[model samples]
Target: MKVLLTGATGFIGSKLLPVLTQEKYDVYTIGRSNLDYAKHTKLDLKDNFAIENLMQSLKPDICLNLAWFVKHKIYWNSDENLDCLSLSTKLMKEFYKNNPNGIFYGFGTFYQYLHDTHIGNNLYTKSKIKTYEILKDFASLSNYKTSWGFIHNVYGKGEPSEKIISYLITKLRNKEEVFVQNPFNKFDFINVVDIANQIFYAIKNNYIGDFDICYGTSFTTQEIAYMICDILNVSKDLIKINHQSDQKFEISSKPLDIYKNINIKDRLCEMIDNL
Candidate 1:
């Protein structure tokens, strides 16, 4: 099978690239530059013309779209939200027009159901929710088949951002004190490898429609810091954990419903050990 991957060098994409290769699929990756993947095409996805043009030339069998601007903290408005969706819609239309039979996997986030609420307090969350709504609605009526994968917090190696796990690991490595916010806020995190495996499964198995993939285990920030301390064989007391009441916005305490018959507890523990 021939596949087109967006954000192929991202945290999930980098890990996913090798998985596709191991499965022996002909993969074409789209991004700003080339990496260690099947074939590379440099095209800025933000430009509709460039995206459509590249899709026309490549004619990939399927497109796994995972490109998006991510930020740790931001508040987005309606116009900003729509703009992000517009880009996604244009990309989808271009891919569908070129490869009508190709499948499109729209990578979404856990903020689909939260907007204008405490959980939606974050601007990034609102934008992601808008993106999901747009894609889900388009997929329902679009001629080509499409699927939406609502992913939870992802953690693994090669993560581009100085994110939660990486940040904590970095501070711990330097033997520096790290202060975390919202210790009581329950957040769902999944291993990047497991998420990539699910996406690969969806592609190979011809999965269409919306699916939620999560680790099912909710860990607090303090707990995560403790895990890191344990992994580094350092005193947990050195890692100062303070609860930020202001940052403790309201959010769903429940975990995402995963359909896969896989256990992630041991895997999460192993990740902690990998530190």
Candidate 2:
């Protein structure tokens, strides 16, 4: 299969690239930076003309759209979210124009569903929901296969330092005190490798539709902090919780039977040790 991948240098893309290669798929990666593995075409996704030309030339069997503005704290309110939504829509149109029978898989976030009660409160979540809605409608009318993978919190190596797990690991490594707000907020954290594996499975099995990629388990901020402390052999006293800032967030009520065999604590420890 000839696969066209955007954001190939990203945390998930970097890991997924090798998996696709090992599966003997013909992969062409599009990103701002040149990648070490697979054939890379360095072009910004914002360049619509370049994206169109690339799509016309490659006409891949599958296009995996993983590019997005992910500055963690700032991304929720950033204008870049809208920019990504626009660019992704254009890219999808171009891909379908050139490869009508191909599959287009895009990434969504758990925040999109979690924030349904207060839609448009966060630009990132709103943009994702809008993008998915628009693209899903377009795909239905165009008779192309499309799927949206709603991802929960993904923790693993090569993640940005601002991400929760990476940030805590950095602070612990430096022996700095960690302060957490909304300690009671529960989240489903999945390892990047498992996410990559699921993507592979979806492509290989032709799983077409909206589905979540999560660990099927929820962990509180305090629980995860304690796990980090235990892994780093640090005192629990170093971790402070701000009760005043606590807010209850919705956890996934959907059953995730796909990852039943996976042990999250072991995976968390492995990630912590690697860091």
* Per-prediction tally of clashes: 3, 0
Candidate 1 overall lDDT versus native = 0.72
Cα lDDT listed for each candidate: 0.72, 0.84
Tell me how far the alpha carbon of residue 133 in candidate 1 is from the true structure, in angstroms, after superposition.
1.8
Candidate 1 per-residue lDDT over residues 56-168, each given as its tens digit: 88888888888665533432443444555677788788878888888888888776655545656665676676666776677668656888888877877666446788788
Model 2 residue 229 CA deviation (Å) reads 2.8
What are the root-mean-square deviations of the candidates from the true structure over C-alphas? 3.7, 2.2
Output the TM-score of candidate 1. Answer: 0.80
lDDT of 2 at 244: 58
Q: Return the lDDT, model 2, position 120.
A: 31
Per-residue error for 272 in candidate 2, Å, reads: 1.8
lDDT of 2 at 89: 97
Where is model 2 more than 4 Å wrong at Cα?
117-120, 173-176, 244-246, 253-258
**Candidate achieving the largest TM-score:** 2
Residues 1-275, model 2: lDDT tens digits: 99998888888988899999999999999888877764898887788889889989999989999989886677888999998999889988998999888999999988877664453368898899899999999999968899989988898987877788888878877789888877888888889999998888888988788888887778887888888888778888888888754347757734244576677779878887787
